[model samples]
Target: MPATGEKVAALGHRYAILLSTFIGLLLISNIVAVKLISAGPLIVDGGVFLFPLVYIVGDVLAEVYGWKASRRAIITGFLLSALASLTIWVVQLSPAAPGWENQDAFEAVLGFVPRIVLASLTAFFVGQLVNAWVLVRLRERTSGRFLRTRLIGSTLIGQLVDTVVFCTIAFYGEISGWDFIGYVALGYAIKCLAEVVLLPVTTRVIARVRAAEAAAIL
Candidate 1:
């Protein structure tokens, strides 16, 4: 059996993988968010598909690695996302080559409004932190039982914060009345529902990860 220290090192190695996936999904979600897609009667940003995965991964991190590790991952994702946005903003501002004809296209794809960027960053940071915090607290309260409850509860709260914050800041005046309410409601509902649908898969992944980490420790 490996020593406890060796096991911890192994677990940390696995964490690195989870952290990378989390950050990659986050950055990609921001980039794709430039486009809005219609799902039935609802309109939501393109990022909706991948964005919720971040929370699912976050739940795995918090449930297995604990809140501190999850917090570190969240902070890392935030800084890296901000960096990506800044880099894109700079690229968008730089003078285009005289013969270049795709500047509009480039901007259309990569350039995001400053307000939207601000809203995304702010919402992501707050929501991720809340997710980790809530999961950790619930773990403590429940003595680590009822993984489904922790996952679902934290995701519902976190996605709500993310949707409301992002929508209010990015589209408060632009979308009013029931439209605004529908937008927020749809986003939150979809995210929560996604979590519910993926619960079984998440349970399996968490179990495998925990078992692997335990074996490594032993």
Candidate 2:
């Protein structure tokens, strides 16, 4: 329940950008995730490139803006992702024009988009909330000390939950037994490692955001 005039105002510019980027990453990841790419010996979805960053951004939001703001962004991304899927479904099902010979191609690429988006939204909503809650809870417990430990711990749990939920929903029956296990296992490992590796950058971004907000108050 948000007032139309003040909805965007509530987010402000800096936090608004973070929210928009979070949603953008979700939409783009879902769109490109249709393709399963070969990264060396590993078979992964195109989303592998962007999903970790999405989580990192989530961490930033939670770390800087706290739980309420983080939850709002997560919910917004979930709803927008659903909207994107619905939009694609409508376009894909519409009658094609005479020169439009790529209907099959369109359907081929965007046909199963709804399912993937469903899985993504579900996983994102659950995973991000858990991550944000854990982060905020830890901040409460530690008085904001141990930033690295909090982030790594939350990412470890959140990514595992997200990976399992997303992979099982998106690729369970689509891939074979061993492949499914590998996909889930590797994706989880990679997401955690990616966040861990980028922890310094993420922490810096969070710190800057907090500092800027504090300066704005003066």
Task: Find the candidate with the highest TM-score and give its number.
Answer: 1
Alpha carbon deviation, residue 25, candidate 2 (Å):
1.5
Per-model TM against the reference: 0.95, 0.90
| lDDT scores of the candidates, listed in order | 0.89, 0.85
What is the model-wide C-alpha lDDT for candidate 1?
A: 0.89
For lDDT, the strongest prediction is 1
Off by over 4 Å in 2: 1-11, 173-179
- lDDT, candidate 1, at 43: 73
- Per-residue CA lDDT of candidate 1, range 1-218, in tens? 54777667887799999999999999888888889888787677888889888888988998999988988999999999999988988988999989999989998888758899999999999999998899999999999999998889998888889889999999999999998898789778888998899999888999999999888876
Error at 146, model 2, angstroms: 0.4
Candidate 2 structure, TM-score to reference: 0.90
